[model samples]
Target: MSTFGDIFGAMRQVILTQARLDQLDVRMTRMAGDIDGLADGISLLRDRISRLEGIIEGAAMAASRQQRRIEE
Candidate 1:
């Protein structure tokens, strides 16, 4: 035979569990969004760096050609 007080305590515990679960869900959502933003930023930086590398390599190749001509 459960008393009224015991029933009230059980309900309070169930409510607390639900509240904590909701908080976790919100935190996970924010974290997922932040991770996506970071990934996008990283991809943009990679593209810029690849372009810069190509430019630097072209300049180096042109300089080498000039040096070879001078040597000849």
Candidate 2:
């Protein structure tokens, strides 16, 4: 028992809602890509930090040996 204007109004609302949903989907997809990029960057940074720590440890050991030699 709906009039033409009521039907048209309902259709318009449905279209607007669908468009909003589509826009949200696109934004979420982009956000997911950004998160993946950030994860990759973080992993790379962790690896570099680990390498630097190893180098520092080696230097410390060498310095300790030199100090011991001097004492003797």
| Best TM-score among the predictions, by candidate number | 2
TM-score of each: 0.86, 0.90
Mind giving the per-residue lDDT tens digits that candidate 1 earns over 4-68?
88999999999999999999999999999999999999999999999999999999999999999
Q: Tell how far residue 34 is off in model 2, in angstroms.
A: 0.5
lDDT of 2 at 62: 100
Kindly give the number of clashing pairs for every candidate: 0, 0
Candidate 1 yields a Cα-based lDDT of: 0.99
lDDT of 1 at 39: 100
Model 2 TM-score, all chains together: 0.90
Q: Lowest-scoring 10 consecutive residues by lDDT in candidate 1? A: 1-10
Error of 1 at 21 (Å): 0.8
- Which residue pairs in candidate 2 have backbone atoms (N, alpha carbon, C) closer than 3 angstroms, thus clashing? none
Give the distance in Å from residue 38's predicted Cα in candidate 1 to where it truly belongs. Answer: 0.8
